[model samples]
Target: MIELTLIGIGTGNPDHLTLQAVAAMRAADLILIPHKGADKDDLAGLRRAICDRYLGASTRVALFDMPQRDPGDPDYHHRVNRWHDRIAAIWQDRIAAELPLLSGKVALLVWGDPSLYDSTLRIAGRLELPLTTRVIPGITAIQALCAAHAIPLNRIGAPVQITTGRQLRDHGWPEAADTIVVMLDGESSFQTLRPEGVQIWWGAYLGMAEELLDHGPLPDAAPRIVATRAAARAAHGWIMDIYLLRRDRDQQAGRA
Candidate 1:
């Protein structure tokens, strides 16, 4: 039986790795790192850095090219499903090649907690191999963002909604939530919202050396964030970012 361990490495910092994650990495018979093309090569490099720091000399490391999702596919869910299916197949191929017997402990370093916005768990489910899956939770970008900003995730007794940029762009603000955390947003979806009483805390490369942060009333920060995000992506060739939006009801009332 193949024991698949999905270890969360947390943002891009090796220091963010938990003791549990380190133990799992050391125990794995094979560790697979995905190459996200030349643009995002740093992603694989970071995973390698983690292994270099934590793993013994005997630990086997394998690298594979990550499949690109077809942006032309108009249906987002369908596109992602197809992409996940491709990734699962690649995992099976890599595992079989490395562990010819097909029975050993395997590990994939995940960004942030696997339970959060990441698709590692979903991709693992698509694997055809008979495997017992395990997760070693690590810090999430949301946690890092909050910690970096030194703020709480929610207001007292208020519910916080976690959503994607697509949801905010398509549905406007969620009616039930005063505080919203937006992830997987390539476009500055906060621009789609009415900025009057909303505050935003935005961070990119949260725990990395090139980390960038901006916050303030949405109206004031939106443009600056867009320009900053664009410049960062151009300089680095890739970017992963998240933002939190909180509507100030008192401020709205005062404005009215």
Candidate 2:
């Protein structure tokens, strides 16, 4: 049976790698790292760095070009499905070439926990090969964001909502929760919300050398976060960021 292990490596920080993740990397016969082009070289580079640091000498590493989603297609899910199919094809070809009989263990290093906003699992499901899969969870961006800010994820006895920037922008703050954490946000969607009683805690490139952090009331912090995000992305050519928003406790109390 072909063993496919999906390992989460945490945010960009090498130190975030768990013992289980390290063991999985060393045990694999081959590891696949996706190349996202020069603009996102750091993504692949970080994977390589981790391999160099932990993988055994007998393990081999392979790089594959990540498939780009077609922006011309307005239907997001359809575009994503096509892109994933292309990626599955690439994975099939690479495995055939690298692990001739497709009998050895292969691993893919994913960012954050595969169970979160990541699509590695869904893409793997499209592979034609018979495979046994396993997952080693890693710290997620939400964990990194909360750690960097030194804050808890939720208020006392309250629910916390995790969402994408697009969702926050399109749906507004969730009525069910006082705390909302936004990820995969390219547009600083927090700006779309009323600033009156909301506070934001934001972090970019969390756990890396170039990490940035900011926090304060939404109205006062939104513009600075936008400008800072733009500047950082220009400087590094890419950035992964997340933010947490909460309605003031007093404000909620007043409403009640």
Name the candidate that leads on lDDT: 1
Candidate 1 residue spans exceeding 4 A from truth: 251-256
Error of 2 at 77 (Å): 0.9
Give per-residue lDDT, candidate 2, residue 69: 91
Candidate 2 has an lDDT of 0.93
Candidate 2, residues 103-211: lDDT per residue as tens digits?
A: 9999999999999999999999999998999999999999999999999999889999999998998898887788999999999999888788898999998889999
| Location of the lowest summed lDDT over 10 successive residues in candidate 1 | 247-256
Write down the TM-score of every candidate: 0.97, 0.97
TM-score computed on alpha carbons, candidate 1: 0.97
lDDT of 1 by residue, 87-199 (tens): 99999999999998989999999999999988999999999998999999999999999999999999899889999999999998887778999999999999998898889
Model 2 has how many clashing residue pairs?
0
Q: Which ten residues in a row have the lowest lDDT in candidate 2?
A: 247-256
Model 2 residue 66 CA deviation (Å) reads: 0.6
Model 1 lDDT at residue 41: 88
